[model samples]
Target chain A: MTVQKVWSLFDRSQLYECYECSKCSGSCPVTLAGDFLGPRKILLKCLQHGSGRVIRDPLLWYCTTCQVCQDRCPQEINIPELLTGLRNKAAKIGNIPERVKFTVEKIAKTGRSVLGFKVERERKRYNLPPVVEISKEEISKILAETGFFKDLKIDH
Target chain B: MALRYAFFPGCVIPAKYPHFESATRAIAKVLDMELVDLPFSCCPPTSNMKLVHYDSWLALAARNLCVAEEQELDILTTCTGCVSTLKEANYIMRQKPNRRRKINRILEKAGRHYEGTIEVFHLLDVLYDHIGLEAIEEKCIYDLNMKVASHYGCHLFRPSYIMYPEFLSPSHSYVPTSIDEITEVLGGEPVKYMRRFLCCGYPLGANVDEDASYEILREKLYYIKAAHAELIAVACASCFEQFELGQVMIKKKYKETYKLPTLYISQLIGLAMGIDNETLGLKEHIHKIKKLLPRLQERTGRMRATL
Candidate 1:
């Protein structure tokens, strides 16, 4: 499917509200420290081309989901939310970076993301009660209902 | 009854920083608040799930909230990311009826509903807004003379529009000095450093661009070191991961030495309240608080005189 066609999946016309003020880019930590494209530029591309075209852009994964862009935007466009929509489209097509995919899979299977036995021992040693596990069966049911397993191609 | 909360320790802290949990429990006892544990899953972790599966993110966080609501207690989270996800999810589900109805539908499969009857509080917010600094001060058995650089990780108030609705209106002054205020009350100097608002970059470390993540961490450490802050006091588990682990990553990846001890806000407060190092899980830190220990002891001596 063409990238623009996929943009139809999201109702994100607030993206079109960007006035190109460059305020979001200016305050963007990723833009400052790394070669990742700034928020304003990403918005410009999405508005000009479409969110689908930018799906494979590795720079999209660099955003820390920090709300600096939305906070600094003069137009009040929710830049992070828009970026998340774009990332959701990316994930739909299996374009997510490996680490993010791994974490997602971990959550899908274990009902929690992080994997370590030390925490269980530490909970005991510290006299803190063990973290109550969310029923994985219930989590899987929700994932299935949300189409998460099918979207990510993870077999339940 | 004291202001009790269903404690929601996000995935990172239990696996990475159990000390944060221990110390929070320690101080919650001192402050007369209950940190009760309940059945829960990920606040679904906003970093990854929000990008890949927005519905899953909202539904998972909503499920956790449903559990808290079932108990009729407000949710208290130690992780900023959890706070951001749960608080914003509550706001969206309640404010936008359609989204609420849609999410509640999916949640029904898990035997949950997003009624939005419960509230979420970050431990820092609970300490500052509920317990009050004066009450915290009154319980202090040790004075901290150390200088602390408070990193109020981004998720706490950013997109301040959602997390803090009052900031959206012109009438409200949204200066985020809560961490600094807490530090002052504990008798630690809160240092002003550049990039104070920069993320600790731990969230990004989970991505392929982990180097860039560490670069952000290095920049913050540089400023904190330059300011000669004794330690970076953080209220978020993710920030604690970055400084505690990111410092080691920096040494190995870039061959730079930045030994900045990152203390969870509760650990710092527990120390000020004269909870011993052993009880605070101070030894579990990857970046040793060894250098700061004697200085803390000296402060404790000062605390004794005042008492």
Candidate 2:
């Protein structure tokens, strides 16, 4: 997606209204946690250097997408949504994280995000009913229909 | 009328933390809340699938909602992450016709369709709003006078517009007190503490950055400990896991022991309602509840003796 296309995904008014106020960064847990570039700086970078530059930054993955920054934004700028859109674009280009890839593959293979073998053992000890099963074929079909396998370049 | 819901036990509760599932089921039985089981998948985990592909996230979440919709039941989720993803997807599908059509096209391939016919709720919502605090209070056998620091995991009410419409008032989302009120009704003091509204950092720490995640956990723990809270109560399985496991990491890395026993809201309520620790899966927790368990037992024993 082009820089213009990226900005167009959001309400342009919300984007333009950003007065460089640092409240987003100030309220951001990821920013407060450590040496990561905060949301305010990220928005500024996207505006100046384009979404491509910001998407490639390792700091982009650090956002927990907790939505705190967006909630606290005076201009109501949806930082989490913007970050998600950027991440989607990054993922399409195969700039995704390994753990994220693993999670998606696991979900595609099994019907859940995490493996259920250990859960099966634990539930037996507790005498709980076995987990309800969903068709893995159906899950993969949905992913393939959504172009997930294509976008992430994961072989089904 | 007995309230019935399709229990949407998200991936984490069953796959990683079955104890949470056990406690929720036990509590549902006491409250007479019928939790119908369904073949459900991950809530697609907002931090993972949503970030990777918006359409896939919506499609997967929509599929789960479709499963519940076919049974003609609303979803009651134990994990806050599932609540957010499924609720947000429902909101988007309901409010936007074009988006719904686009997703339905994908769903058509799987022989499923989401008519947006159902609502999604966190277990806390059903407990506080539908079940009523007075009803819960009446069932309490042990009066827990312990100090509890309630963690209302972020996904429960953030992005206020889509979530809990009642929290649309600007200030309401800023200071959520449903869990606090529930704690009070259970005969426990919901202690005031700083950093109550912050995210638990599980999304970051679990997948992306462990160090940064620990930093966030340490800050939240510092405030809860300073408040002299005897135990931590969490509404989300991810946060419960983070608090329990984070403390172990903090002990090993920082050499500081906060030792606050983190309990799922259901487990905490179950204990006060005279449920046994073994049934609630208290033994599965990383932090030892040795001290708190004895105190609860003592209170119940005294109450029994008086009777």
Q: Model 1, range A30-93, lDDT digits (tens) per residue? A: 8767777888888888888876678888777878887787776767776787788788888888
True contacts kept of 1: 0.77
In terms of docking quality, model 2 is: medium
Quote each prediction's TM-score: 0.93, 0.95
Q: What is the interface RMSD of each candidate, in Å?
A: 2.6, 2.3
The CAPRI class of candidate 1 is medium
- Taking the tens digit of each residue's C-alpha lDDT, what string does model 2 give over A14-118? 666789879889988888789898889888887788787887776778877788887888777888877878888888777778888888788877878877557
Q: Where is the poorest 10-residue window by lDDT in model 2 chain A?
A: A1-10
Cα-lDDT of candidate 2:
0.84
lDDT of each: 0.81, 0.84
Query: Residue A65 of model 2: what lDDT?
Result: 72
Q: Model 1, residue B62: displacement in angstroms?
A: 0.9
DockQ of each: 0.62, 0.66
Local accuracy of candidate 1 as per-residue lDDT tens digits, B1-307: 7888999988888887777788888888888888788988888878898888888888888888899999999999998889999998888888888768878888887778767788898998899899998999888866688889989999998768667776555632144788899989888899999989867787777776778888888888889899989888988877877788888989998898878788888999888888877778988877788777666533433342111
